[model samples]
Target: MREISLDRLRTLVAIADHGSFAEAARVLNLAPPTVSLHIADLEERVGGLLLSRTRGRVQPSAIGETLIERARRLLADAEQALEDVERQVQGLAGRVRLGASTGVIAQLIPQALETLSQEHAGIDVQVAVLTSQQTLQKLADGSLDIGVIALPQSPVKGLKIKPWRRDPVMAFLPARWACPDIISPAWLAAQPLILNDNSTRLSRQVGEWFATEGPQPTPRIQLNYNDAIKSLVAAGYGATVLPHEASTPAPESRIVMRPLQPSLWRELGIAHRAGEVERSTRHVLEVLWELEAL
Candidate 1:
């Protein structure tokens, strides 16, 4: 049998993903007839049917299913090899996919990306906003090159986990509500609360604190974005808690942050798949450690 062509493999993958020859043609910028012809050619080369077409939908045959799995790996390895070559020639010139939870994306990631861009212009960094759970899933699937996640206990298999920094959680209070000095649990309890969304690691920590400090603390509002929560606090709607770096007071000083008596902190770390490490991923991790130090 003749070796199957890369074009044929790509068309097969595209059809499998789109579930229709017309849709695959649109994706690959080919005529629908051309796409059908490619698949026919591929099937003849392999001496088996690859797809079963009904009226509107398409399903891969058993042989097609097995070949699809192999095709995906081939495509992935091909892309990685290209990236590896670029890395060798250009220091760190390739796509690096990174994810971070919502709050960290606001302050931490922007600063880190700026520093990395300045030092290594060749590296192409793409960031996705993910919850801690979603970040873990993507890392496990090799969809992400690295992630800045809240610390995890046992590292994912074939992945390197490194502690990056500890962020002190602080109260965001309206200027009118800002206490003169340190905020005790009682003081925090006194204000109307704008709490973090329940899924967040910071939210879980804050919930535990609330449970210990004052059970059933009433909430005036809830928000997901760090900036939106700060905006509400500044408007005197209610107070919210987040990491210090996640927010800051206005120059004229309408909002302020005060340390809680018991104090709260969250750990942030970098996770990357274990193997021949990608240059862009290493550059990102190094910048994170530098930021943590300062």
Candidate 2:
């Protein structure tokens, strides 16, 4: 601020453009005395004359002309910076960082982003594929604005978690199998399964569902990727259980998506910082809620 304050710079530019200190004062809504003080302060700081009187009118001195040109650019940039911030505050423009699992990111998030693009074209959404634990950690650290995480999550400080979707954990079986209208934990336990890795919450939920029926079933192969699991099921390698997001397309040929009997659910929650959320993030949260399953 000591080098050259924006206020004094603005005063110099105004006086030079109007060619009259009184006229500049009137236009700037500053008193004539305040305008005169601003010019004196600027000249003292610059160590030179900034104004000259020629032919009974005021004009910029040689040094003043150079300073004024640079000042105009600075003022324009400052004004534009303010405008950009204002747009963000109003939720008309901003970049929102969102974190979600690979499954949700592949299937559901794109729908929300597509609507966001059409509605708030200036607002950009940056998505990251992360596990629920990773998502919660990112939200706590302020590196992320939103997180679509699996439910039954442990509480984290400085974070707000809300239930977003409760999708039925459907059994994706090979079409060649003698598939029933609704799959049962007992029947699925007997079949070759391509289940999620044991580390995931979905795997735990699926295990618990089968544990209730009888002994927990083992998987032929455990994977973390839903698309890969479905692809294997399509190849008749094994059956897999996955959450069916609302409005998603049907499964590929040779793969049958059937709801599990006993109605197991894969619940998801949205997480964000607990306080003072940015307007752009709030707008994105609203758009995400629009995708919630009934």
**Local accuracy by lDDT, each model:** 0.81, 0.90
Worst 10 residues of 2 by lDDT: 285-294
Query: Candidate 1 at residue 85, lDDT?
Result: 93
lDDT (0-100) at residue 223 of candidate 2? 82
lDDT of 2: 0.90
The alpha-carbon lDDT assigned to residue 279 of candidate 1 equals 66
lDDT for position 131 in model 2: 85
| Model 1: pairs clashing at backbone N, Cα or C within 3 Å | none
Clashes of 2: 0
Model 2 clash pairs are none
lDDT of 1: 0.81
Summed over model 1, clashes come to: 0
Which stretches of model 1 miss by more than 4 angstroms? 1-84, 87-90, 178-180, 246-252
**TM-score of each prediction:** 0.68, 0.87
